[model samples]
Target: MLKLAVAPVPYHWPRARILSFYADLAKAPCEILYLGETVCAKRRALTPQDWLDLAETLRAAGKEVLLSSLSLIEAASEVSTQRRLCAGSEFLIEANDLGAVTRLRGREFVAGPGINLYNPRFLTRLHALGMRRWIVPIELSRQGLETMQAHCPVDVETEVIGWGRLPLAHSARCFTARVQGLAKDECALSCADHPDGLVLYTQNEQPFLCLNGVQVQSALSHCLIDAVETLQQLGIHSLRLIPQSEGFDAVLRTFDQVRRGATTASSAVEALGRLAPTGLCNGYFHGISGMDWVAPPQVPQGQASLDAPAPRKQ
Candidate 1:
């Protein structure tokens, strides 16, 4: 059975809200939960020990817990945090950067989407170092995944980012800081002001990208609720749902129903639309551009289809 894993929250929220959010997640139907700071090191909403404590709570509730490392390492403090995450024996570690990969020498780890795993050689090296599973990079198309999977060891678990805003790139320079007339070094945690991320717009008032501290993401959420069947056919072991501010519980339940064959893909997609901040997208899965939506030829005859129109490029 395909499992549901909630990726760690990317934006920084208030401490009280963060705690409440996790408490709610504890009751959600997700089987796996990733905890820890995977973005800017200065967020400080949760310390390393704080994340471990949350992991313990989730583990007690029969959820598999994985600790995530920062996507960009800019300071000695960040490197130390990575080492501490790698040293922990209590939970699985998700390495988001090459620096984390280097420190996770003999331990089992997860190659996060940020780590470049475009070729068989890279996968082989990680496998040799005990990489148990990996999430495909957001830009890699379905055909690319097929090629990589053909050469991947059968025992290695393959996961995909099935939901949430597509994380495009990460950098040492904070774009949000620039927007606020602040430098990356002196930026006073401006990301917290926008729980879901500050929306960037084009000159004509069109939504473009989202600025989440040092990470830049697609304005439209990359949704694959309608691609569950195709993902299963491609031998994907699990579907990852990145945490957002709202409707997460409903999102998990919808995916669960679709994965269990209790609900149709289109039905799940419609349910997702009612819950997500933006409309769903499956372009990256169809081998079209990352923003296009190519409806499946067969739509379970007579069922009401809820597919999106073809994408219009900006």
Candidate 2:
């Protein structure tokens, strides 16, 4: 069976809300939980100790807890956090950048989606360095995965960013701070105001992208709820769900049902439309544009269910 894991939160949110959110997640159906500040280092809502404590709590609850490092490391403080996270003997670490991978030498670790592992040679080198698992980068197509999966060592598990807003790019400059007319150094941690990231609209008012401090993501949430069968066929061992502000638990349940063969993919798509912040897309899986959703086999035939309202247009 395909396992479910929740990716670490990408946006900077209040500490109280962060705690409450994870508290709810500890009881959810997710088998694995990737926790830590993987985005801007200045978020400061949780200290390293806070993450360690949360990891222990989740581990006690029978969840496989993995600590993730930042994607864009710009300073000594950020490197220090990475060292501290990797040096720990308690939890497995997910290296989001090459620096983290360098520190994780000789130890089993997870290569996060930020690290570009596109070809067979890349996976082989990482496997030799003790990479026990690798999360497919969001841009890699399904065919791309098929060509690389066979090259991976048998013990190394394969996972994908199965759901959530696609994290497109990261930079040294904080776009969110720039938007607020503040320099990166003097910005007053303003990203907290927009819990789901500030949507960047095109001049004509079409949703184009999102600004999250140093990370720029697609405005449309990248959803693969309709790709369960393809994911299974591709031999993906786990599916990663990036946490969002609303309907997250329901999102997990719907994916869980589809993976278990309890319902059809179209039903899962409809269920996910009700649960996600935006419409679902499986384009990357189908070798199309990342925003396009190619219908899956077994789409439900009846009218949409009344349990949740249709997703609002952005």
Q: Best candidate, TM-score-wise?
A: 2
| Model 2, C-alpha of 11: deviation from truth (Å) | 1.0
Q: How far does residue 62 in candidate 1 sit from its true spot (Å)?
A: 0.2
The digit string of per-residue lDDT tens for model 1 on 1-314 reads 78899998999988788889889878887788888888888899977788888889878988899998888887998888788788765688899998887888888899999888889998998999999999998878888999988999987999999998888888878988899999888899888888888878789965667889999987767788777887889889999998888788888889999898998876676577666565556678767667555544555655334355332333
Off by over 4 Å in 1: 296-314
Clash pairs, model 1 backbone: none
Over the stretch 119-224, how does candidate 2's per-residue lDDT look in tens digits? 9898999999999999998878878888888677889899988888889899889998899999999989999988988888889976678898999987766777
TM-score of each: 0.92, 0.94
RMSD of 1: 3.2
Stretches of candidate 2 off by over 4 Å are 297-314
- The CA lDDT at 175 in model 1 is 89
